[model samples]
Target chain A: MTLFFVVTLNGLTLAALYFLAASGFSLIFGLMRTVNMAHGALLLFGGYVGWSVVDATGLWALGVMAGGLAAALAGALVQIGVLGRMQGDELRQTLASIAISIILADLMLWIWGGTTYQVRTPSWLTGGTRIEVLGIGYATVRLYLMVFALSVGVGLWLFIQKTRIGAVIRAGVDDQDMLRALGYPINRIFVLVFAMGGMLAGMAGVIAGSALSIAPGTDLQFLLSSLVVVIVGGMGSVGGAALGALLIGLAEQYGLAYAPTYAAVVTFVIMVFVLAVRPQGLLGRAEA
Target chain B: MGTEALLRLSNINLHYGSSHVLHDVSLELSDRPLGILGRNGVGKTSICNAIFGLEPITSGTIMLGDQDLSKLTPEKRAQAGLGYVPQGRRIFRSLTVEEHLRILERKGGNWTTERVYQTFPRLKERRRNLGDRLSGGEQQMLAISRALLLNPQVLVLDEPTEGLAPAIVTDVVELINQVAQEGTSVLLVEQNLHAALAAVQDVAIIVGGEVVERVTAEALENDPKMQKQHLGLEAAGA
Candidate 1:
């Protein structure tokens, strides 16, 4: 029972990180249909940058902001330089993004020296608190991560539902040309969304890096996990990303506990199962 | 009628990968609604598309008021007081009727969301319904309402009544006439001659992508032979 509670807590915390990384991937892919193969690189890049900042300044929040901003800038450059010119050619976009990921990975190696680095958790989140109800203790940072993920989810949902720009985003997701015709500058919207996605990826990287080791090629794993999350959650949906993260996180935890060797493959199995049953995903609108 | 046309297209030429579609097509819209009449393949919709900056013209100029619109983007053209209801309605399938209006709502316009709801009471009833869930007529209504809420200096509609039933057609035509009467200059492109005649003050007939005839709507209404010559519409009880 204690083992179950501990695993559940760990799974939920991991789910939070997955939600952060996958939400941006899903948003960018769902809105523009651009496969950002470089997303994982961005995540690692953010983590490295965040670690550097915290090492220099000893300020964790500043590290998080710096990481997010760095990734946002990188995302904007990628969109304008590579993805924007592809003109709906998926093959070209995919190839371009993969090239970007490789280049970014090499840059990370050159800068960070191919060594795994962990960002120090803030003083407030360094310890664990015992929960009397569950008869277990969980790291305070893990609780913070879960709360942060929930806040982001709720905040994103509110923005997409209540704000004017959110309306334009939703409208553009349906018919981009019509949104343009309505006098809302869609290119600007696209840039904003891409940047936001990058920021989220970066933010996720910083938070996850503090909790776990971030190193070379770590992005590929995170990217793969995000792919599963999006596929299972439904593409282009905020709610879908959360659900998908939860499912993948729980499945991974269970798999790791029972059959440690095959834990990585479990996410794929879940993805294949979901795809076989509902191709559009759990919350995706049926393609007409 | 005046020296300055509100919306002017001069010697416009459009091409689709070297296939010339619009050839030296010129049009002037003033206070009165101008109905563009043409059969399919005659580039009637192309004219509207060009005016809205949807398709780039190979050569020519489009003037909206004092601004030269040929170089501007579609959104810029819209900001310059141009409203367009493109062919196929092009409604955002996921947005609600209220969201459709709310997304494009601008301040200081006589056309507000409440005003649009009052104009199309049925739209008010389906305010929360997604664009895809509405009937064809209701979709058309939402499209027009969205454009109207922009309070454009000129409204361009391309075949808005194409697939609507007869009863809904009357309602749509009535709404078009009402919009025009409320002092918004209208450019209506239609293949239906009767609706065109009823909705506009002037007629510009295009055949094979060139303006073959330009006359008053009343003149086209009175002359059956001219309508037969250009529109190929047979006379009554022929």
Candidate 2:
């Protein structure tokens, strides 16, 4: 029973990280329809930046913030300097982004080398805390990460649902031409959204580094997980991303714990099932 | 007619690939509403698209007031006081009726969200419903209301009454008049001859992608011979 409880908590923590990574991916896909194949590269870059910041400044929060900002700048540049020119050409955009991801991965490897780097947590988050009710000690950083992810989820939901800019974004999702006809500078909005998606991915990278460790191939791993989560949850939906993450995360952990040999196939099976049943995704609207 | 031209298209020519779509199309809109009347496939919507910069004109210029709008993009043209309610009432399906008004609502503008709701009470009733859920009449009202929220100097409506019932058609014609009376110059494009004649003061007839004639609505109404020759319609009273 104790092992099951611990594993469930572990699944939740992992799900939180996946949510942070996939939310940005989903947002970019929802509005721009760009596959953004380089999302995992951005996450790895952010993680590396966070590690360096923490190594130099010894401030964990500052490292997280710096990592997010760096990734955001890179994301905006990608949109303006490359993706913007290929607007409306999805195949070219996807191919271009894939090339970009490869280049970014190589560049990051050259700068940071092959060594694994773990972001040093603050003293408060360094150890585990005993929960009296659960009668177990859980890693403090992982707990905080789950809470942080929850806060970000709520905040993002509010931004999309309640604010005026959010309303414009929703409208744009419905009809880009009409929104432009209403005098909106859509290109600028596209850049802003890309930056925002990058920020979330970057922050998730730092959190992932603090909780585990980041290396070169970490980018590909997170990228695959993000793709699966968004595909299962529904493209372009934040709620869908969260739900997808939770299901995938829990399934992976449970599979690893009980059926070790089949652990790798668990997430894939869920995705295949979802695609067969609902091609638009669980929460996604059918194509109009 | 003497109130100064608000929107002018001069010698405008457009071609899609090698085929020409509009040829030397010219128009002048003043204080009184101007209606472009044509049969199907006469390139009326193309003119609106050109004015909004959706399609680049092959040659000539579109002028909004004294400012040249030929070089601007669609969004920039809209910013320069050209509000368009496109054909088929292209409302955002994901956006609710209230969201449509809220996003475009400008502070200190003549058309406020409150004013729009008051003007079209049915829209207020359907405020929480998604745009696609509204009836055709309600969708048309929402489309018109959103354009008015821009407080534009000129409002261009393309087939505002298409696919609507007769009673709703009457309401749309009346709404066009009200918009014109509120000091916004109207550019109405329609195939419904009666509705166009009822709503606008001046009319430009298009045939084979060219402006055949520009005449007062009253003159066209009385001259059945010209009506049949151009519009293929009997006299208004007949």
Candidate 3:
């Protein structure tokens, strides 16, 4: 029972990380229909930047903010410089993003080298805390990460549901042409959304580094997980991303605990199952 | 009708790759609502698209009261005081009716959300409903009201009466007339001749992508032979 509880907690923690990564990925896809293959590269770059900021300032929160800002700047540049040029061509945009990912990954490798790095957690979050009711100890950082993810999810939901800017975004998601006809500078909106997505990925990178270790392939791993998560949960839906992340996170942890050899294939299986059962995804609206 | 032109399309030409769509289409919209009547695929919608910069015109100048809109993008054209209620109503499926009204509301604009709601009480009643959830008549009213919130100098409506019940059509005609009377220039594009004639003060008949005739509603109403020659109508019917 204790083992099950610990694994469940681990699953929840991992799910939080996945949600942070996939929510942005799903949002960008929802509004622009751009696949943004470079999302993983952005995450990895953010992790490196966070590590450097933490190394310089010795402030974990500052590092997280700096990392997010760096990623956001990069995301906006990517949209303005590359993606915006091929606005309506999805294939070209996807290809350009893939190329960008390759270049960014190589650039990060050149600068940071092949060394693995971890963002040192603040002293308060360094150790485990006991849950008095269950009499179980869990890592404080992981618990905080779960809470942080929840806060972000709630904040995003409120922003999208209640704010005027959120309404415009929702309207753009529904009909880009109509939104344009209504006198919205859609290109600027696209850049803003991309920057926002990058900011989330960057913060997630910092969080992931603090909770776990980040290496060269960390980007590809998170990217794959995000793809699977969005695919299983539904594309372009925040709620869908959360559900998908939870399912994949639990499945992965349980598989690793119970069947180490086949653990890697578990997430893919869930994605395949979802695709077969519901091609539009669990919460994704069907194309008109 | 006011003699001073509020919107003008001078020597406009549009091409879809190799094939020409609108050829030397010149129009001057004064204070009165002008209707462009034509059969399907006769370049009526193309004219709207050209004005909005949805499709780049081969050559021409579109001026909204001396502001050259030919070079502007669709959004820019919209911001420059042209409100478009596109064909099919194109309501954002994810947005609620209230959101639609709120998204386009400009500060100190002539049309406010309160005014729109007052105008179409049904929209206020369905304020919480997603755009796609509304009935066809309700959607049309929301679309019109959404554009009205922009407080545009000119409102372009494409097929406002299409796919509507006769009773709803009557309501839409009344709404168009009311909108024009409120001081906004209207460019109405429609296939329904009676609805167009009833709503607009003047009518332009487009045949083979060219304006074959431009006459007052009264003149077109009295001349059934002209209607049959240009619009393929057996006769003007009630």
Q: Least accurate stretch of 10 residues (summed lDDT) in model 3 chain A? A: A279-288
Best-first order by TM-score:
3, 2, 1
- Native interface contact recovery, all models: 0.71, 0.73, 0.90
Q: Which 10-residue span in candidate 1 chain A carries the lowest summed lDDT? A: A81-90
Docking class of 2: medium
User: What DockQ results do all the predictions give, each relative to the true complex?
Assistant: 0.65, 0.70, 0.81
- Best-matching candidate per DockQ: 3
User: TM-score for the first chain of model 2?
Assistant: 0.98
> Which pairs, if any, clash in model 1?
none
Write down the DockQ of candidate 3. Answer: 0.81
lDDT of 2 by residue, A210-234 (tens): 9988999998998999999999999
The number of the candidate with the highest TM-score is 3
**Per-residue lDDT of model 1, residues B95-143, tens digit only:** 7898899888878889999888888899999999989999999999999
Candidate 2 C-alpha RMSD relative to the actual structure: 2.8
- Tell me the lDDT of model 2 at A155: 97
